[model samples]
Target: AEIGKGFLLPSASISSKTKEQMPAIPKEIERAEEEGVKILYLTLPTEITGKNGRVNGLKCVPLVLDEIDAEGRRKPLPISASEFLLK
Candidate 1:
């Protein structure tokens, strides 16, 4: 489980992704203070890449929901988008 989330563990990390990669991210870092998130590192998901360098999506669910052994991480219900990083 520790290895699975290794990429996000660093304090100051740099990731390279365009809007095409993950539509969730902002396109430009115009003002560092303007955006709420202070990015530390970049993480590359295990997915196929197209010629355009865009992610083709994951083949599997990554980990089976039933296989999750961490009790704290095992959410009884789906999490809201706002509190996603907290848990």
Candidate 2:
């Protein structure tokens, strides 16, 4: 009960997760930028989103797509389940 409550609070749940990413995340983002991999969306279609817009359920891999440009520059694109899975 309390565990689920935390998700609805004043964004505390996200703060801790963000803190854990730390300085490493900035560098990782930079590297990803070079690799043409950009993070477009924050959630996946596989997860169920509640009325409050919070994703509820277990998640395995992140559903990001690698739609790089002809020059190989990664363009951050939105994703769908069937579209991604089929590819």
Candidate 3:
């Protein structure tokens, strides 16, 4: 399984640059869906110093080079996000 981090932020309290750095959750979900993945797990850090308990940063998604896609593009399988958060 792959592992990574994700950040969360309040609606109007985070910087634009920080927001830009965050990964697109919808895209991740989409990619997983395309693969026929049965489960999607996410880890949300409980304690954060900025923006009143909201997250503002995320680690890069851990991907495994499993195979090539229909377009001759290498596809990666991501680790479960739940494992990290529950810990």
- Runs of candidate 3 with Cα error greater than 4 angstroms are 1-60, 81-87
Q: How do all models score by TM-score?
A: 0.17, 0.25, 0.26
lDDT of 3 by residue, 1-87 (tens): 022213232222121222223355767645654544423232223333335676544433334444667888554455456322211
Taking all chains together, the TM-score of candidate 3 against the true structure is 0.26
After aligning candidate 1 to the native by TM-score, how far in Å is the CA of 32 from where it should be? 5.0
How high is the CA lDDT of each candidate model? 0.31, 0.37, 0.38
* Model 2: per-residue Cα lDDT over 1-87, one tens digit each: 223334543211111112233345677655654544433233343433344765444332233435667997553343444332201
Which ranges in model 2 have alpha carbons more than 4 Å from their true place?
A: 1-24, 47-86
Model 1 score (lDDT): 0.31
- lDDT for model 3 comes to 0.38
Task: Point out where model 1 deviates above 4 Å.
Answer: 1-14, 17-27, 46-86
Candidate 2 overall lDDT versus native: 0.37
Better of 2 and 3 by TM-score: 3
- Local lDDT at 67 for model 2: 67
Residue range with the least summed lDDT across 10 consecutive positions in model 2: 10-19
